[model samples]
Target: MKLRAYLLMLAVVGIWGCTFVLIKDALSDASPLAFNTVRMTLAFLVLAIAYRRHWREINRHQLIAGVIVGFFLAAGYQFQTAGLAKTTPSKSAFITGLVVVLVPLFSTVKALRPVGARAPRWNAYLGAFLAFAGILLLTVPAGSGVLPDFNAVNSGDLLTFGCSVAFTLHCIALGHTSPRIAFQPLALLQIGFCALFMMISTPILEHPQMRVTPRLILALAIAAVLATAAAFSIQSWAQSILPATHTALILTLEPVFAWITSFLFLGERMGLRPASGAIIILAGIAITELIPQPHVPTSHEA
Candidate 1:
C-alpha cells in the first residue's frame, strides 16, 4: 500500500513537470490569474460533474478546510505562473523546488512545538539536501563545468520561491486534512475554491484576458484535466498514507523531469552536469526510502 502511494505521487510529479512548458506557453497569451482561473475552473467543473452524487456528503468542516487548503493551492500556482513569465523554466523550477527543504523544516518545527508529530528521520534531511543540490545543478547554467551566475537571481526567482513556500504549506495542509474527509469531495471543493479565488483576484490585480486560440485551449485542457484534477486527486489520496516530508522528497524529481521534457520538446540541450544532477536526485530518494536506521537499545533493554 505504501509503495503504491509513493508510485502514485511519482506519477503526479511527472504530470506536473510537463506542465512547466505548457504553462509558460499559455502565460504568453493570458495573464497568470486569468489562466489559473480558467484552468482550475475547468478542473473543478469536470470533477463536479463526475461526482455530483457525492456533493451532499461534504460537511461544514470539510467545506471550510477545503477552502483554506485551496487558498494555499491557488496561491502556489498563482505565484508560480506569474513567476514563470519572467524566468526561464529551469530557473523557475529550481527555485520552486526549494519546498524539498521547506517541508522537513516545517515538519521538524511543528514536531518540536508539542504538535503530536515526530521529528523527521535523519534520512529525510539527507535526501532533501541532496535533492536541493541536484536541483541547483539541474537548473543553473554551467560556467566552467560547474555553478552558474549567482547574480542571475531576480524578482522572478523571489516569486517562484514564494510559490515553493505556498506549495510546501499545501502538502503540509493535506497531511493534516486529507484523512478527515472524503478525498474526492474535498478535492472538488478545494479546486472549486481555488478557481473562485483566482477569478475574484484576477480582475483586481491584473488586466485579465484569455484568447480563445486552439493552442491556448489545448494547454488549458491538459493542465485542467491531467495536471490539476487528476494530480490533486492522486496527491490528496496519497498523503493520507505518507508523510509530508516523504512526499516532498519524491517531488524533487519535478525539475529533472522538466529538464527531460524541455530537452525532448523544446530542443534544450542537456549537458553532463544536469545528467549527473538527475542521478543524484534519484539517489537521494532511494537513500531516504530504502535505507534503514540502526537500532538503538533503550535503557530498559539488555
Candidate 2:
C-alpha cells in the first residue's frame, strides 16, 4: 500500500511537471490570476460533480481543514503562475523545487503538529540536501555556475519563493487532514475552496483578462482536469499514507520531468551537468528510502 502511494505521488508530479509549459503558453493569452481562477474553478466544478454524493459527509473539522489547505493551495498557485510570467522557466522551476527543503523545516514547527507535521528523519534531511543540490544543477543555466546570482534577485524569484513556502504548508495540511476525513469530501472541499479563493482574489490582485484562444482552452482543460482535479485527488490519497517530507522529496522530480518535457516539446537539450544532477537526485531518493530509520519511543513508551 505504501509503495502504491509512492507510485501515485510519482504520477501526480509527472502530471504537474508537464504543466509548466502549458501554463507558460496559457499565460500569453490570459493574466496569471485570471487563468488560475478559471483553471481552479473548472477543477472544482469537475470534482463537485464527480463527488456530488459526498458533500453531506463533510463536517466542521473537514471544513476547517479544507479551507486552510485550500488557502495555501490557492496562494501557492497564485505565486507560481505570477512568478512564471516574470521569470525564466529554469529559475522558476529551481525556486519552486525549494519546497523539498521547506517541508522538513516547516514540519518542525510545534504549531503545525495538529496538522500531522513530523520531525523528518536524518536521512530525509540528507536526501533534501542532495535533491536541492541536484535541482540547482538541473535548473541553473550552464554559464551561470551552480549558485544563483543573488545580486540579480527579481520580483519573480521572490514570488516563487513565496510559492515554495505556501506549498510546504499545503503539503503538511493535507498530510494531516487526509487521513482523518473521507477522501471524496476532503478532495472536493479543497478543490472547491481553492477555486473560491482564487476567484475572490483575481480582481483584487490584477486586471483579469483572457483571450478565448484554442491554445488557452487546451491549457485550461489539461490543467484543470488532469493537473488540478486528478492530481490533487491522488495527492490527498497518497499523502494519507506518506509523510509530508517523503512526499516533498518525491516531488523534487518535478523539475526533472519539466526538463524532460521541455526537451521533448521545445527542443531544449540537457547538458552533462543536468544529467549528473538527475542521477544525484535519484541517489538521494534511494538513500532516503533504503536507509534504516531510527525508531523513536512514543511518549507512553518513553
Candidate 3:
C-alpha cells in the first residue's frame, strides 16, 4: 500500500512536470486566467458527474475545508500559469519546486507549537535541509555558473515563488483534512470551488482570449482530466494514508520531470550544477523514504 501511494505521487508529479511546458505552449494565444478558468471548470464538471454519488456525504466541516484548500489550489495555479508565460518552463519548474522546502518548514512549525504537539522527528528536519540544498544547486542558472541572480529576479520568478507558497498551503491543508473527510466528495468540492472562483475572477482580471487551436484544446483536456481531477483525487486519497513530509519528498521529483519534459519538448539543456542538484534531491528523497521511521504513538496507545 505504501509503495503504491509513493508510485501514485510520482506519477502525479510527472504529469505536473510536463504541464509546465504544455501550459507555456497553451498560453501563447490564451490568457492565463481564462485558460485556468476553462480547465478548472471542465475538471469540476467531470468530477461532479463521476463522483455525483459522493455529494450526499459532504457536511459543513468538509465544505469549509474544501473551500480553504480550493482557494489555495486556484491561486497557486494562477501564479504558476502567469509565471510560466514570462519565464522558461525549466526555470518555472525549479522555482515551483520550492514547495518541497516549504512543506517541511510548516510541518516543523506545527510540531513545535507549544500547545498542540511534540516537535517533528529529527530525520524530517535533516531531510528537509538536504532537499533545500539540492534545490539551490538544481535551480542555479546554467550560463552564469553562479547562484541565482536575485537582483535580476523577474516578476515571473516572484509569482512562481508565490505559487510555491500557495501549493504548500494546499498540501498541508489536504494532509489535515483528507483523513477526516470522504476523499471523493472532498476532492469534488475542492475542484468545484476552484472552478467557481476562477469563473468569477477570469472575466474581471483577464483580457479573455482563446484561439481554439488543436494544441490549446489538447492542453485544456489533458489538464482538466488527468492533471486536475485525477491527480488531485489521487493526492487526496494518498495524503490520507501518507505523511505530508513524505509526500513533499516524493514531489521534489517534479522539477526533474519538468527538466526532462522541457528538454524533450522545448529543447532545454542542463549543466553540471543542475544535474548534480537533481541527483542530490533524489538522495534526499531516498533518505526520507528508505530510512526506518521511529513510531509515533496514537492517543489510544498505553
Candidate 4:
C-alpha cells in the first residue's frame, strides 16, 4: 500500500508537472479561457458519461463542493495558461509548485480553517519554509543574483505569480475538501464549474476562437484528457491513500519535471544563475520532505 501510494503520487506530479509546455503549445491556437473551457467541458462529458447512471454517487452537497472547487481550479489555470505564454514552462512549473509551500501557511489562516483541528507537524513547517525559499530563488530577481536582466516586474512574471497564488489557494482548499467528499462526484462537479466559468471568462478576456490544427488538436486532447481529466482522477485517488504532507512533498518536484521537459522538448533555456536557483529551490523542497520526524508520545505516556 505504501509503495502503491508513493508511485501514485509520483505519477500525478510527473504528469501534471509537464502540462505547462502542453498548455503553451495548446495556446498557440486557443485563447486561455477558450482552452480552459474546452478542456473542462470535454473532461466533464467524458466523466459524466461514466457516472451518468450513478446518480446516487454524489449528494447535492458534494456536487456543490465540487463546483466550488472547480471555480478555484479554473481561476488558477486561467492565469497559469496565460502566463506560460510569456515565461518558459520550466520557470512557471517551479513557481507554480509554491502551492505546496502555501498549503501549510493557508491551513493556519483564521478564516480558511478552524483552529480546532490538529496542527501540522514541524516537518510540514519546514516544507513550507523550503518551498518559500525555492519560490524566492526562482521569482525574486533584483538581488537574487540569478537574472540581472530578469525583470522582476515583468507583466508576464507577475501574471505567473498570480497563477502561483491562485493555484496555491486551490490546493489548500482541496486539502480541506478532499477529506470529506467522494472523489468522483467532487471531480465531476469541480471541472463542471471550471468549464462554466472559463467559457464565460474567455469571451471577456480574450477572443474566443480556436484554429483546428493537428498539433493544436493533439495538445488539447492531451491536456484535457491526460492532464486535466486523468490527472484529477489520479490526484483524487492518491490523496485518498497518502498523507497530505507527503502529497505536497512529491508535488514539490513539479517544476523540475517542467524544467526538464522544456529543455529537452521545447529547447527553452535557463541561464546558469537561474538554473542554479531552481536547483536550490528543488533541494530545499526535497529536504523539507525527507527530513527526519520527531517521535510523538502516546496517551499511555501521560
- Output the TM-score of candidate 2: 0.79
Candidate 1 lDDT, 214-255, residue by residue in tens: 878988998988887777667767866887557655676777
| Model 2 clashes, total count | 0
**Ten residues in sequence with the least summed lDDT for candidate 3:** 293-302
Please, what are the lDDT tens digits per residue for candidate 3 over residues 78-185? 888888888778778776765654554566665423233345556656766776676666554534645475455567867777887787777677667765777788
Q: Looking at candidate 2, what is the lDDT of residue 275?
A: 70
For model 2, what is the alpha-carbon lDDT of residue 150?
Answer: 49
**lDDT accuracy of residue 210 in candidate 4:** 86
Clash pairs (backbone) in predicted model 2: none
Off by over 4 Å in 1: 1-11, 111-115, 127-151, 235-250, 270-302
- Number of the predicted model whose TM-score against the real structure is largest: 4
* Order of quality (TM-score): 4, 3, 2, 1
Cα deviation of 90, candidate 4, in Å: 0.3
Q: Is candidate 2 or candidate 3 better by TM-score?
A: 3
Residue pairs in collision within model 1: none
Off by over 4 Å in 2: 1-11, 114-118, 127-148, 236-250, 269-302
Candidate 2 lDDT (Cα, whole model)?
0.72
The Cα local distance difference test for each model comes to 0.71, 0.72, 0.73, 0.68
Candidate 1, lDDT over the whole model: 0.71
